[model samples]
Target: MKNSVKYAVTGALAGAANGFFGAGGGLFLVPLLAAWTKLEERKAFATSVAVILPLSAVSAIVYWFRGGLDFMTAWPYLIGGAIGGIIAGRVFQKVNMLWLRRVFGLLILYGGVRAVLLL
Candidate 1:
């Protein structure tokens, strides 16, 4: 398939996942980008973040329109997330990709376990 097609498919899947899950586009995007587009690990990670930002914003807007969002409750996390994002963006280049991948895997494992247990 052409690169445009590959990217469109990937974006569609990521957007679906993000819209349905309220988040997690990056979880799908990172691996898909690495596998389908043959992007390097670090580049895939960065690209996923870029893509997710818009996906998340769109999701949030939809949720807000549906009265599903509570900005009062979300404000604290938004403030903290902004600070965290800034720090992560600054330090991202310094982190080793292998360790980053391992950490990402562990977080996914942890989330999966928690989700299963909750169910």
Candidate 2:
């Protein structure tokens, strides 16, 4: 029951962020879940990726139905993204977790700083 509530809340938050941010719900979900659930950063990141797929599919469907999706240009990007994602996933298996955490933390910080400065 508790697990279900946590996932429900996480899903809602992820969906909301995904709707507005044009990027990751991870930007919000990571720290929230980390702090709330005490998840290690890598575990949190993996969880975020798992959560993102369904939300992204729903969003993609909306765009496609609205005629906002362009397959001709999007197809190449999709192929490249899939290849890169696969390679990155493989590379992640080789990376040290401590170092990966530091890098991921730095990336989140950098993105936050960039957004604040740009905004």
Where does candidate 1 clash, by residue pair?
A: none
The candidate that achieves the highest TM-score relative to the unseen native structure: 1
lDDT of 1: 0.92
Error of 2 at 56 (Å): 0.8
RMSD per model, one decimal: 1.4, 2.5
TM-score of each: 0.92, 0.76
| Candidate 1 per-residue lDDT over residues 7-114, each given as its tens digit | 898898899989998778888899989998899989999999999999989999999999999999999999999999999989999999989999999998998899
Candidate 1 regions with alpha-carbon error over 4 angstroms:
none
lDDT of 2 by residue, 1-119 (tens): 88778867877888887766646688767777787788987788778887787888887778789888787988898899899989988897688988877887798789889989995
Q: Once superposed on the true structure, which residue ranges of model 2 sit more than 4 Å away at CA?
A: 32-41
Worst lDDT run of 10 residues, candidate 1, spans: 1-10
The CA lDDT at 35 in model 2 is 77
